[model samples]
Target: MSNSVNLDDIIISKRALHLSENSSLDEMADALQVQQRGVWPLYDDNAKGLEQVQVKTFHYAQCNVKVQFNPARIKSSAAKVDNKSIKERKCFLCTDALPPKQKGIPFNDEYLVLVNPYPIFPRHLTIPRLEHAPQFIEPYFRDMLELSRALKSYTVFYNGPKCGASAPDHMHFQAGNKGFLPVETEYSKLKATTDRKLFSNEHLEIFAVSNYLRKFIAIESDEMTLLQTAFEWLYELLEQRGQEPEPMLNILSGYENGKWRVLVFPRDKHRPDQYFAEGDENILLSPASVDFGGVCITPQEKDFKMIKAADLIDIFAQVSVTDSYFDELCAAYAKRVVE
Candidate 1:
């Protein structure tokens, strides 16, 4: 299917711009929020859901995980992303398929940043490519870096096709207000004390954070090219070990203090067995970058209230790569960097 909608057709031109030619993406996004709330009733209602959302925190030795009871996220948490189901449904991320009232800010004539109607953060933005494409990160990882820098106040994240993307066939990245996730605050502490250093130099540093409930690789650098090169190497390493078309992983990135910090959450499965379990056993929780970052989303209130620390441990264990595999991958990457 073709994304036939023109850039001019969906760009929030009038009020969002304030007649300014140099409005930053962050400013434009704020403007889009105001315009969307007034013009889009569905978004307005869901945006209000953020207020009623309940949260409970579970503390671990090294970090804490927050479970958000967000009823508005049922559409995404329970999204049917199977190949057959995906083929039958229209692509919602496509510009032509968006609601009439929905509008966005065009980025470098490549992506359209639109307000997410079903939000998990106080301010949520969904940035989708202009063309219809599969959800893959390698080719667009640099774009993510650029977006994070451009929207400095937001954390840009990617949910792999099988990792957490509801629309697995579409290419998109999501941005939420910074500090919404626990990792944004906890990562520095982990890095200083417990995280295992894989590689480091003047331009780039990579560390493996295995103590966190979910295992992830952290890449940090002040230079964009160096960061991108390190990520590409890591991507190749992941591809060599995985059977999937693309290595199963979710990425969370942010730009602050003239540097980019990227976290890669490698996955072994999309959802835990609890997701498919019968009635009382079923916990409708589908983890994405936010979840890995420590704010686990539970669409159903029952799951929210009943989910315990042990259950989260079990879920993370089931979805994340095994400890042995993770260690081996880290070792291999560390060795490769030196050679």
Candidate 2:
């Protein structure tokens, strides 16, 4: 850590340095891959995870949902995040516990941008807080947006502690190389087809996309202050509705052409019944931000091979906010906008 370093300074200097050195995300990704290959056997083993993964796509309700059989993710997909379990394990995101060779770029002088050993995208990064902090988002979402802007070629996402964060004990966000998720391509169509605009001003545009299989609210703005204010308003509303600590949600953010697009999925359930189901009915599918964004991860081959369009629709219905609830939230938001 340097005394002269600040968020703006880090953003400007790091991107300038990296752009001069690597020129593009692909080159930087290759550098990370090379580094991981040299020191991280786990990463090398899981980089091979893509090879063993079998992918199947299904068109459900006009949305293309892809299921991937990723056995290497079983440990994460089935982690017991109960208090007892979390307390027993060493916090892997902690700097001291990190592998010696795992290097990272400084972020805001309070976080580190490191390559994710287990990746869902070809180039995935885990940005964890320098201090061991409980997984929380509202306080650091502005930072997430800044990271997205700095990365430019990647989409940043956050999984709530209970919703999908494997390291629930630590505050972190992940970035994946753009163009990986179906949601990125389908979003434009979704806005036109299913999303209902809830708020629009010079500074921001907010839309609720409930009919898009998974219900979520999308906010876009070029100004961080406006976006942050809107998010806080939504947070307060959800909290008043009794979502403790914070609303159970997952977020996906992307920055391009001077606009930051953020999608927030409000959740009522953690894992669906199929996760706890017996024998043949069991599917280890966990609905994370990426899952809500259209790519579902199935850690078991059988589940991946067997999950159908109807099953996906059902899983989404079970995990996402109910249609009625989403409708109510949208209505409330619309009314607030009008008032």
Candidate 3:
């Protein structure tokens, strides 16, 4: 799945080149509003949802989880993920198929960063590879870290092919305004309460977040090489447990103060059973990278109205890896890496 287009041939605007890295991305988002008619209409949809959106905030000792009813996300929430169904549709991410008004900034000669029409955050973006490819993180984890650094006001995230990615056939990442997800603000507090240190070295430290209700691993480092190595090791450990092309996981990364902080959510399932339940029990909730980051989106009003804190707890527990497996994996991680 490769496209023949050469990234260098793509012309980026002179204004895009003159602005600072972070400012350039901000301007691109702003330009999308005036350049693309679809942007604000969708934003208006978000505003409408916010007004009518039912929300339930679960109180936990570690952090609070916010669930929002956003009907605009139904397409993504209940996307047809089967290979046949995927093949039947046009690849929307492809440049030739993109909306005429949509424009993007060339990123590192391999990706195009564009504003996302259906936004989960106040400001959201989707960055896709020039060539079509499967969604995998190992090859691009370092790039995610770099993007996080370049867009200092945003957090970069990845959704695995079997995770929440709607365009599983295209290698891509997403960026959202910082502080939108509770995880960004609650990480340090959660770390203090839940950190299970696996390995520590001069520049890199790895910890498994044990008490955050969902299973996740955190990697922090000032050195990209060291962080990449540790991340690969973690990937391998998770990969060995399953036979998939890559492990089922989602990633969130942020960089500040000369260091990168990455959180990995290991998943055992995509949609929870409630999504498939009979009439009265069915919920249109699908967990994604943002969900793991503490904001769950439900595209149906009924689902949002009926869902409770306990239901959310159950959904997370069912999708995330079991506690015992996480503990064993952490112990193995400690032994696999030498400080």
The top-ranked prediction according to lDDT is 1
C-alpha lDDT values of all predictions: 0.90, 0.81, 0.81
Worst 10 residues of 2 by lDDT: 5-14
**TM-score of predicted structure 3:** 0.90
TM-score of 2: 0.90
Model 2 per-residue lDDT tens digits across residues 1-339:
223334342222324334465355434544655666667788888877776667888986768888888887788799888889999998888776776556666666887777888788877888899877889898998998888887788889999988989988899999888888998999899888754889888778889887778888999999988888878877767666676556899999999999999999999888999999999999998889889888899988889878888888888888888888888888887776557
**Candidate numbers sorted by lDDT from highest down:** 1, 2, 3
1 against 3, candidate with superior TM-score: 1
Predictions: Cα RMSD each: 1.3, 4.1, 2.9
Q: Which candidate wins on TM-score?
A: 1
Flag regions of model 3 displaced more than 4 Å.
1-54
Residues 212-263, model 3: lDDT tens digits: 8788999999998888888988888998887476898989998888999999
TM-score of each: 0.97, 0.90, 0.90
User: Regarding lDDT, does 1 or 3 come out ahead?
Assistant: 1
| lDDT digits (tens) for residues 115-185 of candidate 1 | 99999998999999988899999999999999999999999999999999998898999999999999999
Error of 2 at 210 (Å): 1.4
